[model samples]
Target: MYHTWMRYFTPSPAHHRLGLVCLGVGLQHGALPAVGPRVLDHHVAVVISAGRGWFRGADGRRRTVTAPALLWLTPGVTHHYAPDPDTGWDEAFVDFTGPATAAYADLGYLDADGPVVALTDTATARTAIGRIARAARQGNPFLEVETAAAVHELLVALRRVRADTGADGHPVLQALARDAFQPLSVIEHAARHGMTPAELRTAVRRGAGCSPKDYLLGIRLGRAKELLVGTELPVAAIARRVGYDDPAYFSRLFARRVGTAPVHFREQQCRSVPGGFTDRIPDPSRPPTIPPSAPADDGRRGGG
Candidate 1:
């Protein structure tokens, strides 16, 4: 009889590269069905949709996974997974390639040589994935925007999964990491948590291996890079958005960290386009997704 739902599909470059690189979602289900013992030729990753399963990696280690969780499997990573015979399993997956994929690698989420990394409490992630799956299936003109939003949501949810582990740091530091997207000065951030700047810096350094200022700067830079490549905003506008008042200073800072000036970075991204990265998602019907709501400023509310 029916045990699990297991279906898989590959995204075309039109959907994968142009809409959002490293962005595609699928739903899988079947009767006692599961991916057979094999290695993915492409970076195939999944988050469980329903039921329970176990993943055996190349290193001979096994990780038990359950519904509403994430599993990242890189290309050629020998692995096998199957749903429980009784309960079966359901899953959603996405395959992607792009600079953002490198970010995942930096965070140690991509392991081509070992067992799966199980992400806990992935309900939010599943929701985002589902949204992307629907978008992919519909092949909507605004598919790119939909997939981009879904990808952003997935990252936010995945980051939350890491925060919940409460490992490698104090709870307070972990909490700070969770909310690092807030636009606050280091002193202000410390004050909110009843800590002095020095104490906060020490705590973060000891626990997360980075100072609070550096952490915040990394967050800003990441956002800046996204804006530089994803949007058409001028460098000066992006600089101000990321807390740099001087465009020239922001250019230098970006160059130091990203190995290229803002303009050059944008140029390189455009030149290195993976065939479909710039194709307008062909739908004039749907409006663009609005940007995320900004946090209130420190008594600087209300723009002219």
Candidate 2:
């Protein structure tokens, strides 16, 4: 016979604005019963950590569900699944919903189009799940907000362990970010990696959830802002430093994307930078997943 432990919650309306409300969480294993050929009104991420099973989606095709796979039971979608009786399966599931789900889906973090996502490892994801379960303890008082925050952590963990990312996260994305400040067109950038523009587009979209053009612009503009506030660099010099030789064009682009001219942005933020600028900024190319292990900032200003 199967065994299971679960908890359910009904958070208040105000908590729903937190962008991810965990409705329920469960851990199960052993011989389990079959689930619906029905639909759900919200989203559930059923992560199978061990054993095997089968899943049938609205597409009317049945596919084998293996260990380290994520089943995306999304809103308005039909799903059906069951574990293999003899082998059984271990699973941890989280049910969540919010307006932010659409944005996450758009960002390539959540996709019901391919309902089953293969994972390379579930250790990290399981840790996040355990955190949710603990936060779900009755009368925790901080329950609503705590569980919701853990749900966001769980999503990031899953993204990290996706089979496509391997052990180093997204190499292509890292490389793209490293070279982002170079003055190059998207086509030219693609050529550097031995990729066609279309191929580069697909890779960036899958890894970063944005177009290559958008990704490079994000990096360039971010560096431009840092330089503006951290140094007495002229707007024209800052423009060239961030890959644009034309200060006029750079100002127009910055205004359109960041809602202000560069000089004004620097003026507004320069004085508010806590300890004020440092002698060197951390390289902006590194992924957020990689932490800076360098020594603490020496608290100097400008490059001397």
Candidate 3:
């Protein structure tokens, strides 16, 4: 005989901001009845712990659902799935919705396009789902809080698996690291990597958790900070070295992003040390045989 247990929830406003609100959770063991060539308004994640099944999405694509795999049912997408009657699969599922879900999708943490994904660590996934199920069954007053917390944990677990499996874009990161100082447009940078601007943006956002332009600017600002503390170069010279042709513009940007003017930053760093400005700024004339390992020098600039 098959056994099934499930719970549903009505989330409060606070739960929505937590980035994941569990609407329902369930566990089933049986020959699952087929569900929908219909659409769902919220996302659902169904995990098959044992046996086999079939899944079809709105695109009219059919996929085989196997043990230790996740079948993602995206919001507003038509989907249908069922377990084999002969084998009778064991399944655990969670239905959730939140703002972070869209961000997660963009970051490649969630695959909306591909409905079925093979999980690298099924045990961890199972444990996360189990926690949500157990917590939901308790009927506690803090069910919303507890379930939301578990959902966050579950997302973390999924991201961990993705990281371990090398699923992120390494090439895009290398390109950004190489060209951060250049005043290249996002489109130009994408062209160097043979990807469209949109594709590059998505890849960088997924890998670095920021837009490509912001990632590049971060590198430039980091180098600027190093130069400000380690060298007595004029603000204009430092600005030019990093990629900014217009000293005034660079100063404005620097003040805005770093919360201090370039000269002020240098003064502050010099004051923090014992001997003053002379002690902080290195002598460029006498290049030491062995470069200082502790202090890094980066010479690159972005355009105005």
Candidate 4:
């Protein structure tokens, strides 16, 4: 015999703009029955924490699904899976859909290419799912938004705990982000890291699924947006702070890539933060305080 419990929601269009909305969350275990050889319209992360199963994707390869595994059911993809009838797997799943999934896919976080991912551990992923499950509680007023936020957390957790990702992320990515705001060209950054430009590109493409230049630009732009909303700094000042010496060039780049001018972005995003701690004075030990009013803003929006 098996047990199952779940909650599902239909978030409003306004909530969907937050970039990810959780459609459902569930827990099942103890000789659970099989699931679809069907195509889905949204994504589902089926995290197996214990026992075992088997999965067959569009390729029709019947792959073994052991404990500590992730089954990614991507939108429009055909999939099938079931826990062993005799010793069913303990599983938690969250179904989600949003524009952000495209970006996450590009960044190598969502791998449709590898539908079954071996996980290093289920701890973090389970914790994230737990957040979703809590938010899914019956009569919870914050159900839609809270569960949506947890879905984002769940994706990050899944990405980090993937057996391939190795301790959260690549050392190269950490170094690149650490030096992102430095005024250095791709070639210069590579040379400093004792690598050729081609080598740097390869490393970044493997870890971040983007070129080194694009990776640093993502970091720089994310910082720029934080400054735009969180501080009273002038556009020129923010530009310079994020490594662009020419203010006009910076504005153009920001507008072109961000789909709005920096000033306009600020106008749309600016808010009176509760604590009035607007200045983002860089402290190595502390994280920059982006206002909590924009709960949807995880700060990685336009960067990648």
Say which candidate scores most in lDDT. 2
lDDT of 4 by residue, 197-274 (tens): 999998888788898978888889998998888788899999999999999999998998899999999999858554
In candidate 3, what are the lDDT values of residues 1-304, reduced to their tens digit?
A: 5789899999989778888899999989888788888888898888777888899988787888887678888888889999888997888888999998887786666788778877655677778888887787665888888888888777666665543244334667876888877767899999998999999987887776788888887888888887788766788887887778888998999899889998888888773433323425557997547565764446554558
Task: Report model 4's TM-score to 2 decimal places.
Answer: 0.70
Q: Name the best candidate (by TM-score).
A: 2
TM value for model 1: 0.53
Q: What's the best-to-worst order under TM-score?
A: 2, 4, 3, 1
Off by over 4 Å in 4: 181-183, 191-199, 218-304
**lDDT of the structure predicted as candidate 3:** 0.80
In model 1, how many backbone clashes occur?
14
Candidate 1 stretches greater than 4 Å from native = 3-24, 108-115, 118-120, 162-213, 216-304
Better structure of 2 and 3 per lDDT = 2
Query: For residues 1-304, could you state the per-residue lDDT of candidate 2 as single tens digits?
Result: 9999999999899999999999999999998999999898999999999999999999989999999899999899899999999999999999999888888887788988889999998998899889889998768999989889888888888888899785545788888888887889999988998999999999989887899999999989988988888777799998998889789999999999999999899888845544545646477896336566987688775675
For model 1, how does the per-residue alpha-carbon lDDT over 1-304 read when each residue is reduced to its tens digit?
Answer: 5533232345465555443354445666654555657876556557676778788777767678776666776666677777787777777677655546655554444445434445656677777777776776544676666666676667556656643344334676766666665657789889988999999987776445567877777877887877778788899998888877888987887898889899888888774423323435646787666699998679967679
Ranking by lDDT: 2, 4, 3, 1
Question: Which residue pairs show collisions in model 4?
Answer: none
Off by over 4 Å in 3: 162-202, 205-210, 215-304
Candidate 3 similarity to native, TM-score: 0.63
